[model samples]
Structure formats: C-alpha cells, structure tokens
Target chain A: MRPLTETETQTLFAKLANYTGTSLKNLIAPLDNGPNADRYVFRIQQSRCYYFTKTGKFRLHITALPILAEHARYKVWVKANGEMPFLYGGHIVKAHVGRWSDDCPEHQGVVVYSMNDTPLGFGVTARSTQEARRLDPTGITCFRQADCGEYLRDEDSLFATS
Target chain B: MAPTRTTTIKSKHATNKSGIQNSKTSSKARSNGSSGDGVSKKSAKSKRTTSKGVALGSVTGKGAALNKLRKKRRVYTERELGIPTLNMITPVGVEKPRGGKKGKVFVDDRESMLTILSLVHAEKDGQIESKMMKARQMEEIREARKAEAEKRVEERKSKLDETKEGLKKKRKRASAARELEGEGGRREEEVKGTKALKLKKTVSFA
Candidate 1:
C-alpha cells in the first residue's frame, strides 16, 4: 500500500460511509508526514486507525477493525462470551449476533465486534443489519472474512503452556 | 619479407624458457591431448595458439602482438547493460529512470500501512493518547449497560417469584372451601353464607 493524501483519505471515508450506511468521523486519523511517509498501512492507536495504500489510496487491514468498532459504523456484533474457536471458524450465523450496525448492506465488508464492543475480526454482511434485527433467526447475518484470533492460534503452538 | 622476418624473430624468442612459460600460462587448455608426454603436448598446444602469423615484424613488438590478438566482439550492447545514465538536462523534481527493463518498472516493496506502522514506527506518538481515552470511555459505557441489564433481570425474577407465591396461596384457599362444601349440606350453606358475608364486609371496608 502507498501513502494516501488527505483528499484521498477523505474520499475513501465517504465511500466507506456510503457502502456501510453510517456516519464516520474521528474514527480514523492520518499521521503527519515524516520519514515514514508514503508507507501504506493503518495502525490502531487508542480508538482510531490510520490507513493508506501504495497507490496513494486509503486502505484497511484486519487489525484496524477494533478501533473502528467504536464508531459502530459498518460493523456487526458477535456474542462476546463465545470461544475463540467459533470466531476463527469463518461463520457468522444468527446465533453469533449480539447486535449490528443499523442498515449495513449485505456483502459489504464490516468490522465484527464482541458484545462488549471489542473488535474480534472483519466479515462480510450476509444479511442486512435491519433484517438481522428482525424475526429471521437461523441463517447467517455476516460471513467471517478474517479473524484476529487466527494470529493468536498460530503462535499457540510456538509457545505451548505445558 | 616483413612477415617472414617477424616469424623468424618470434621463433628465436619462442625457444627461450621465459617466452615458452609466458605463452603456456596465458592460453587456457582447450582440450587434453593424447599425443606425447603431458608437458610437451601442452607446450605444443600453447605454442600453436600464441604463434599465429602477424603480417609485419616480430610478435615481440607490442603492435605486432596487438595485430595477432583475438578479434572477438562483445555479445551485449551498452544499452543492454541496464545501467541508468545520469540525466543532467531534466528537472530535479521529475521521476528518474530506475534501471531494469525498458517497459518494466521495479516498484518498492509495499505493505499495508498499519503493518508498516506497527512493525517499524512503534514508538512514534501518532495521536495515540486521544484514541485510548475514547476507547476507555466506550468501555465504561459498555460496562454500565451490562450492569443495568443484569439489574433489570434480577428485579424481574423477584417480581415473578412474588406473583407465583400469591397464585399458590389463592389455589390452597379455594381447595379448603371446596372440601368444606363436600362435608355436609348445612356446612356448604354455611360456607356460601360466610363467603357472601365476607365479600359484603370487604366491599363495605373498601
């Protein structure tokens, strides 16, 4: 990814809002240009993630999902108490939904959060957020696209508890 | 005449050990010969390669040796070397040529912006404090909501138990009244009379 100019960043934010149907402001911020300028990446600081791309475009990484959770925009909620395995399993059935962003479109990328509002990963909406909130209760609301716990599981074998 | 004179002079020098040694070491062995002893045959081969006839005087002269030198042309061209020549006339701000192939350009290794920041620029303060504060605020709100939900559940459970107890007491009193009614005609009439009297008394009290 390449570094995105302020204009490109703003445009991308607008595109994201349009895609997910939510207002997003102060959810992301760009750092000042320095020696590390032109590096396309986003870092989750406290509550915000900064992102850019090699093509001078705005881009997002899986890790940035958590910071975006605070916005509740373009997001889906999963049961927080569920085991880590359920998250990495790449399924987002209705049983997993605790809540979701209002009117999130089907097939759009979304930040997946736990009931407690911590970001668990990213997913694609299988059902609209409005529909997921309605009476239909057995199908998937979102498709698991990426899981943050996958990295944890990868490192698990490297440092066994025993 | 000049060519014959050069050959005779070179032959005189070739008989010397230094000339033989120099020629022998200079030319690499092309093939192993099965002719005579290895040293003699190797020397003969070296002599053949170095003693090619020059049109002029003896090969001892530098010019004569140069004429005898191999005329092999290079296989690649200056443009094919892929070295970028400095463009002095162009403006400084313009993108410079990065040497590779003509149509192909080499791009630097690009990574996701977040990956680059976390891996290399971890220490730099990129408005992190404010972000943390916002997250903390969210966490506090979440905790408050959870606590409130739990409290509501507890209150509902208590109310439900109270209602269940009241229903049980009402059923017991009704069963006792029915048993009294079954005992005798006078008793049943007395119970009905008492119930009517109690209802009248309660209504008047109200």
Candidate 2:
C-alpha cells in the first residue's frame, strides 16, 4: 500500500472514473488535500481516520486495512509488529482484480472497498481519531472509530451532536 | 637425598587437618561464581520490564495529536518493503521508481468495478480460511515426522547397547583364557613328576 506518485495518482483516478462511471472530480469531490499538506481525506461512510506524514510515499488507509483489522496479516513485514495474531484470519479483497465477496455479506468487515477502484464508503464507519487518542503519545493527532463520534482533547471529551 | 635423619614435630593436636586445602577449594569456587553467575543481571532486567506508565505503540492514553502521529509512523506498506505493488494515491508530484512500470488505478467500467470490488472482498475472506487450514495441516505433518525420527533414534541406541554387552562378555572370556594359560605355565614341578612317575611304573612292572 505505497502512496501513489503524481503519475500513479492520475492513473488511479483515471481508473476510478473508468470503473465508477464518473470523473475523478466527481468520485473524490472536494475531500480537501490543499491546506492539509501531505494529508488526504476521502469519505469512507461516516468514519474519518486521520494520517499525518513527513513522508507520504505510502497511503495510511491501505496500511490500516491490513494492520488494524483481522484479515490484513498478508504482509510478512507487518507480522513483526506483534500484530499478526489480530489480523491473521482477516483477508483483503483485491478491489479491482476479481470477484470474491458474493456470498459472505456477514463478513463485510474483512473486506476493504478501495477509494481508488471501488465504492469508497461501502462499509466504512463514521468514526474519528479523537476517541482513539489514548493509543497515541505524540499529541500531534488522534483517531476515532466510535459510532457516537466522541472527540477527546487534553483530559476532556466533546461529544458530537446527533 | 643428604638429609637422612628425620625429625617429626607434633602439633597441639596430633591429627593432620586438611583445613588449608579446603579453604583453597572454597576460594576457587567463589571466584568462579562471581564471573559466571547470571543472577545479578537477571534481577536488573526483571525491574525494567515491569515498570510501565504507558505503551508507546498502543495509541491509547496519548493526546489526540500524538495518537495520530504514532499511527502514521508505524505504518507498513508494500512501498516500504519495495515489493511488486499496486496502490492509489495522489500522484501529482510523486516520481516513479527508476525503470519500474508506472501503474494507475483506472475504472474502465464503474458498474463492473463495484461488482468486482464486492467479489474481491469475498475472495479475501475465503483465502484466509484456506490458509489457516493449510498451516494446521502442515504442522501436523511436521509433528508426525519428528515422532518417527525419535522412534528410530531410540531403537538404534538400544541395539547399540546390546552389541556392546555382547562385546563385553567376549572380552571377559578371552581374558579368563589368558589367566588360565598363565596358571598352567607353572609346569617345572609337573614335568619332573611326570618323568619320575613313568620310570617308577616301568621298574615296578619289570
């Protein structure tokens, strides 16, 4: 899950438009990558996970599918982080290559819908990094995957309005 | 060699004590312990692995901004490992690897892509299940092979012991035969007795 170079990006966007029946602008819209510097945002349902980079050669979203979830233990490099157990049973559906996820609708959590090739928000939850700040020590960013959309500050939490 | 006269001085206690020898042996043992004993280092490590205010990688208990940074830093992708890879990112200024084929995420058909994505998702789950079952099967095979090897080793060892015992008995019997030859070699008196006895028998018969 390397970051797309400008050329790769263009190619991916082209592919997205080709497959989604829309242009890159139509599919991606204005998720906004301008003031954010290396940060890129795309809608994956209500869930919004944040990733920061001094280097942006690889996409954080792609890495997350294998690292955070159960089916992502495909990479030998990732198994070293002591996270192989959590992701061992989970497998990622190659979004473009072939058809795979027909019978296992209940197993949608194991499947990842790519933003570049398929339905971007197919099964993504509307979570933020705020609740997930407890896992970070850097204090520069945070994440959340809660259905309630709770944002955590320094020793404080702000609940989202319904 | 010149000191032919021997004089013995008796201590307060007549008994010869090995206290000095015992002390030297204990001192040697103590020196060995100081250099080789791992007890001190083990204790120190026990103290360090136990203390924990926070886990650096857990991404929990850190402030909002820090949590996000840690998550990004620990990110591992196909690009990092430099594998034959495919991904979609904003490719505006990012250069391609030297001589590597530049790939793009293209949609020739949206409806088809959506259908394909769903299919891909299903495929990934089945693949994981199949992989797990395969690993289990392989492990069972390895265990069976190991058990068979161990059984063969034990059988060989027992056979060797039996051969050694047979050799031991053979050696003992050969050694006893040599002892008997040594005993019978004392034949000087018997030779004289044999000659004298033969002469007396002939004289008595005459």
Candidate 3:
C-alpha cells in the first residue's frame, strides 16, 4: 500500500474514533513529497491495526476525505466484485505526539498509537481491520471539510499541566 | 297498584234475628264492618245485618217464621201419615237442638292457587339473578387478587436473582482466597506423610 498522505493519516484516526469510541494519537507518518511517493503511513488507535493512505485528520467530529479516498481505493473492488472493502487500523488512540521534526527521519509527519496493545482495563481494543471490513452499513458518506484543526495529544496537553 | 284482579262475592245471612228496634240496633253494632268496604259502610245490609245480630241475644227474631214453617211441615206430615208413628218426644241417643242457625261457608276456587304459585316463581327468579350477579362480582375480585399476587411473585423473583448474583460473586472471591492460602499447608502435609511412611518402612526393615 502507498503511504498515507497527511490528510489520509488524519482521516484514519478520526474514523477509528468514529467506528470505535476511541481514537489514535500521534500515529502519523510523513510522505517525502517526493514525486514517486503518493501518501503517508499512519496507524489508528484502539483496535491496533494499520493502514496506508492519502488524506485527512482526526477531528472531534468526523470529516470525510481520508475515509472517502480510502474507500475509493478499494471501492473499485466493491463496485466490480460487489464485495465490501477491508479496514486497516491499530490500537493507540492515546499515542503521545512526538516532535514532527523535518529534522529527524521518523519525526516528519504525524505519530499515532494503538489501544489494543495497551491492556483491557486501560482501554479497549477496537475491532480488527477484518472485522471493520465486514461491516456492511448502507451509507458510505464522505467528509464535509478538508482540513481539521489540531487535536490535543496528551493528558497534560489539555492544560499543558492542568 | 292492584297486585291481583279479583271479585269477591259476599252474602250476609241472619245468624241472629230478634224482632225489636232496640235489639236490631244492638245487632248492627255487633257486626264490625270491614274497612274500605263501601257497601258495609253505607249500611246496605242494614235490616238483614241488624236482624241477625238482634236475634243472637234472643234466638227468636229473624228465623222465627222458618221455625214455625218447619213445625207446620212436621205437623202436616203427622196428619197425612198412613203408617204408625212415634210421638214427638225426646229419645235417648238422639242429637237434638242447637239454638242458632249457621250461614253458608265461602271458599276460593282452584285458579287462585295458580296466581299464588306464579307470584312465588317471580320472587324466586329475582333472587336467582341477584345471586348470579353476586357470584360474578366475587369472581372479579379473585382475578384482581391473582394478578396482584403474580406481580408480587415476579418482583420477589427478580430480587432473589439479584441477591444470588451478589452472593455468587462474594463466594467466588472467598473461595479463591481460601484455595491460595491452603495450597502451602496441603503441600507441607503431603511431604510430612511421605517422610513418615519412609521412616516406618526403614524401622520395620531394621
């Protein structure tokens, strides 16, 4: 799979939160913006699974692009094969944000985490990508906004200490 | 409302008859008039009613002529007799003279019996209907009580289930704790038993 674009990383986490009640934090990867590169690689939290995509961010509410684009990529199979597309996510809606440094190799884009790898009492594992793929909800709606503002990454991030 | 349709025929005959105005007045006073009987109130049977009572004191007033007529008939029969006859004197074992005459006896016919039966039937039918209504009301009360009982039973069942679940959780925790504590003791006892048996065998061999 191609890496997730910055938009793709954002939308994936937002959907992970929407589909499950929790979302991922800091599971973002930067696309080199190299002509050959198409998107970024990001992981969603809760049900720790992985995905490669192109477009959006995790909003307090759901926004559409990354999900729409992801749907579009595998949507061809659903259209032609009349089968549902699959989901790819991970478990860490609580990944603390790291420095998104243009200076480091891994610190370029967004960083996200998974909740499943965390224990049960701590949080819950979202359903696996396989489970999400089997979901045959009728409406495959898209996003209303393209860019979602920044999300708080830590408990301290809320008040920076509050 | 007249409960029954009936026409009663009453005939007043002279029970006592005495031929004097004073006696007749007393006689009229003697026959107490039935209330609401218009004819009697009007003094309609004044003479007959008067005469009957009048003669009750004297025995020789209203029926004096009938007495004479009966005597005359008996005399005539005696004169016309062709056979030997006994003298008109009292004889032993003969049931003789009571002084007064008795009036005719009146009676109700059989059809009145049917009216009485019909009235009784109507009263009984009403009683039966009331009894049935009472039974239905009692049945309704029973059903209401049964429903109340069922609701109470269900509430009790739910409460019991909650208590059982709580007890089960508590018991599980207690048992798990006991098992952990007992583990070392049980293992130690087993080791001691094995050592004692080995010692016994050694002693026996020696």
Q: Which stretches of candidate 2 lie over 4 Å from their true place?
A: A1-162, B1-122, B180-206
Q: Every model's DockQ, to 2 decimals?
A: 0.03, 0.01, 0.00
Ranking by DockQ: 1, 2, 3
Q: Candidate 3 lDDT, tens digit per residue, B1-206?
A: 34332221111223234323345443565456654445665676576555655565367655666654543533545446533333334343374558756542321222332343344444544543465456556657978999999999999999999999999999999999999878877678678785543324343554
Native contacts retained by candidate 1: 0.00
Worst 10 residues of 3 chain A by lDDT: A99-108
Candidate 1 wrong stretches, greater than 4 Å? A5-59, A80-85, A133-138, A153-162, B1-206
Q: B1-206, model 1: which lDDT tens digit per residue? A: 89999998887655553323345432333223443456777788677656654334353687666664543434775467643444334544675668855642322234332333233223222223344455456557978999999999999999999999999989999998888766776666677785543324343554
Evaluate residue B182 in candidate 3 and report its C-alpha lDDT on the 0 to 100 scale.
Answer: 83
Return the candidate ranking by lDDT, descending.
Answer: 1, 2, 3
Kept native contacts, as fractions per model, are 0.00, 0.00, 0.00
Best candidate, TM-score-wise?
A: 1
In terms of TM-score, which candidate is stronger, 1 or 2? 1
Per-residue lDDT of B118-194 in model 2, one digit per residue for the tens? 45434554554564456556657978998999999999999999999999999999999999886675565466575
